[model samples]
Target chain A: MMSELDDDLVARAQHGDAAALEQLLGAVRVVAVRYCRARLGRTVGAFTTADDLAQEICLAVFHGLARVRGPLITYMYGIASHKVTDALRTAGRTAVLHSLDELEGRADISPGPEDAAVAAELSAQLARLLATLPPQHREIIVLRIMVGLPAEQVGAALNLSAANVRLIQHRALAQLRPVANEILSEVNP
Target chain B: MTAHHDQHTEPAEVQHDEHLAHKLATGQPGLPQDPLSILLAACRDDIRAAENPAMPLLANAAHVAVRGHRRRTLLAIAAATLVSGGAAAVVLARDAQPGSPLWPITELVYTEHADLALIRMALGDARAAITQGRYTDAQIHLDEAARLLTRITPGTPAQQLAAEIGTLRQELAAHLAAPAQQSEPASQTPGARAATPASAGGTTGAPTDPGSPGQRPATPTPGGQPPVPPGRDRPQPGEQQRTTTRGSSRPPR
Candidate 1:
């Protein structure tokens, strides 16, 4: 169910209602972090931790909450989307390298053989395929498909028109089709 | 090689490819043996975990909001203090002068020079816009230049040069505010327009004897050089001269 907090909670939070504010933030954290991880995963070597980045998103939402007057989820998601995009821009290639380094550094952690092989193969393929799409296209696909934001909300969050969002989504899907087909074929073969 | 392949076989392949393309585009859930599913699932779990009520994410946001509010309050207080301090300084300076120190004149010159500089920048920006065929943007800069120049004060002599500078600025503003068809070529002379009134103010012409009270002094212009009458010796001693000129130009308010 969508979060039901209203403008009153937002106003109260602006006047320093910590509890109401926390409730508002809790409602949207799922979609927000998912959006961040997906967009960040496409980057190279991000140095900042995901939890830290998510915290930054939370801060931006709280700071900007007074100006946003809508359903808490929509407003929160909008703030989250902007924060995720900003984090991606700031982190650039570093995010991907950092994720890979983290994986490599965990020598004590043992994956089952099947899981390890699959993880390595999938990570390598994603790294290569993600490089093919433009940053904007990659962002929209991750937000809509992986993060599961509706088209209207994605458009609002990204500061794009809904029509533009759909158009970009279409282009992104078309571009991914051949890669998806090749991946399926390779796996089946 | 013995039996010819059916043409229908090629059509079937094309249809199958089309169907697969549609499925991929639609993101239909037919779980292919893709390994990324586990990773995707894991990421989904992380997202869910982040949403938990026990996490500190929400509490952190509350702290940040409080800090931001405090910072904004501090900035506003600082700005108010600065403005009040500046007004007090102006009052004390005025009281210390025996005769009317022409503050109005100085204000006029400072205002005029600033307005002129603004106009010049606007004109340059407009020229750039015109070249780019962005008439709307060019018009905006031109309008701002005009508004700045219209406020020029002309009569104050204690700040006479400043007023003159203001007049020149207004002139520049007027030029810029004209229709695109009438815009003048950029000024070729540096500080030329501001220098026009120096002779008329009696500061540049025949030096007044030091003994005379009403006579303009022949004191060597602040740069240790002979004074050129209006329209003549341009002060070229960089920022020092400009500062002295501004100081000498304040009008009796």
Candidate 2:
């Protein structure tokens, strides 16, 4: 699902166009941040900074541009996923995420906060729900929802057919139904 | 979506899934897309402004990539030399510029750059100085690089390195000679914009044997007129031995 522009950027980056590398990473920074934030979930504020994690991923991607054999997103996601998973392994040792029973009360939604925070609260709730699913399903939902990549692109990155991407996304959303129904309904437009 | 439990479905179910899929891609409905935008903005700004200690990292990385390529090239060439009994492909990758195969790998290889690390250090110094409007310092460091470039044999494997230095010298010379080009890079350095005008004002209006602008910038202009006493600036009305600094102020102290 690599776009022609991304392919061009990647080619230029590999050829050591420093500005192109800078631009390529700048273009993808948002997605990388989203992925890292989702994977970090509740651990973001406590265990690691999402910005730092995303920057680390960018540095890795920048340095490793030559090793990319597939779409740029896949290579980026691969590095971010590894970094997040490694951090999670360490996180699981000392900290515990709220159990399913505690999920409702754990969300500290401030009444006077801006709508984006409310949106983020809902998104955080969704991320918690996403965490409950298996890794494969979780990845599809994040890339599809958080990163806003097309299923075709997601499918190409993940090596699944577009239909399979849709199917997995459907299943993943189904799993989030319990949390989504309770939290998202109350969010403002 | 209906929890039919079977992933395989009828066209009706497929239609439902498609509708749900559209919503799903937007993130659990009303979740305010891009939950991390604010958090990500800070990091993006950090990179864009080059405000971190790792700002030089990309330049180092370019060097690293070129080094890796050099290792591979040398190994390949060595293998080829052995296989062909000291015969090889044309030894000159002169056509390989920075984006080309020869330039990046062969031209910039550490061994090819005379004095290896010293030349790199000097070039980095020159680059930073150039970006800061310190063309004099840039010329000095570039001069060091050129001196090193000459130590490299003309027809040897490092000839390309010498050529690269020659190009850098020409560029540095241009930056040194042009007052206008010098002003542009000042904005790149911290506190340089403020310093640029002072420097430009100093050089431009220092009385070129006639009444000119900015002989004294930090002083006031009454009625927008210059504050110079008329005859005082023009050599005391007939005193001999008047000399202005070469392209500068303060009379060559």
Candidate 3:
């Protein structure tokens, strides 16, 4: 639904409609926020918030709007891909220090009473499993399953055909299943 | 998604995994209690529970950016309009006459070069008035032309216009000094009609004499004034000589 609205808004914005561009920025910001949240779910000491990363992506999209030739969502996701990757690299550099800091901060950092601690662990495990895949396959799965974009949009974002996207996704899920089954047995038993 | 499902199923386990992946990707309902479905569902549930404290701030930032962008765009358009509109006004007002509606614009944009146009316009009015036998009205226009000639740029065309103004002023003076009082000045006696010399002398005193404000009082108050009255309260011609380049519409070379 948002992808459809994005296409129409992209057309209007490219034709110099500022209101359409604003609306498009807003819609894209929401999706970017979701993608950043899902991808960065388990970073230990998030020096940068997912919303900040999403805001950065929206700003990049706004600045690069005139140069966009393909779908606006695809262009926006392309920016998202780079920003998230840069953020992850930064987080990786600080991971050991953050982990040491987490030891002291564990009591304050406990999952809240109303929240499911197992869900947080499971989300971390899922992120770890996803991190094991190749970058392109990981991106496809994230955009397809986690971000809930249609396969066609994922294909467009990654510059692949939809059929290729499905093939990659199928192979990716097959690879994830064994490890997923192992995690599932550990969690359930 | 279904099309990809039917086309790529090789085995039962693969088909089952593909179905689960499809359900998760498309957010379909009624999933089986498979290992992958539970794992993915737990991940989705955790992500859904993740705090988004920055959503409102992000939204506000987007609004601010949009408003700023809109303001910048409007300012750009306004600047372009001012530039292009000014150029268009100069172009349209190039041929405007002294008393025509666009005359002020012409005078403003083509300040140094505009005296020639002003002289031409006054000459045109004087010629038109003389043909209609309004001698006092013609004298007023010729006087305006003579006043313009005092500070007009010195060039061949200006010299030509000055000579034409000279001849027209002389002819108008002769016509006003005639004894007939034939045209519209019903109250003027012969002695009052003899103020054509004063009108002609006003132009000479305008360029050389600084303290003579009362010299042209009788010249402007005559009964047979032109339909479009002269600017009696205008500044002195010496003070009005803003001799810039006048680049807009200078005659050839």
TM-score (all chains, Cα) for each model: 0.38, 0.42, 0.49
> Between which residue pairs do clashes occur in model 3?
none
Question: How badly does each model clash, as a count of residue pairs?
Answer: 26, 1, 0
Cα lDDT for residue B129, candidate 2: 64
Model 2, residue B221: C-alpha shift (Å): 19
**Model 3 TM-score relative to the real fold:** 0.49
**DockQ for the candidate 3 complex?**
0.11
Tens digits of per-residue lDDT for model 1, B1-253: 1122334444444344334333333355663434334333333333333344333342322222234452343234333423542232222222221112212211222345433444455556655654554333444444444454455564453254344434433443343233222322255233553355632364543221111222222232453222222222332345223222222121222
Q: Candidate 1 chain A: minimum summed lDDT over ten consecutive residues — where? A: A41-50
Which rank order by lDDT, best down to worst? 3, 2, 1
Query: Over the stretch B37-88, how does candidate 3's per-residue lDDT look in tens digits?
Result: 7777767655545433333432323222333442244234334433552343
Which ranges of candidate 3 are over 4 A from the true structure?
A16-19, A44-48, A96-116, B1-19, B50-253
Top-DockQ structure, candidate number: 3
Residues B141-247 of candidate 2 have per-residue lDDT tens digits of 66566655555556754565566566666565454334433334433654554454644445444322122221222332344322232222323222221111100
What's the true lDDT of residue B15 in model 3?
Answer: 51
- Looking at model 3 chain A, report the run of 10 residues with the lowest lDDT sum: A42-51
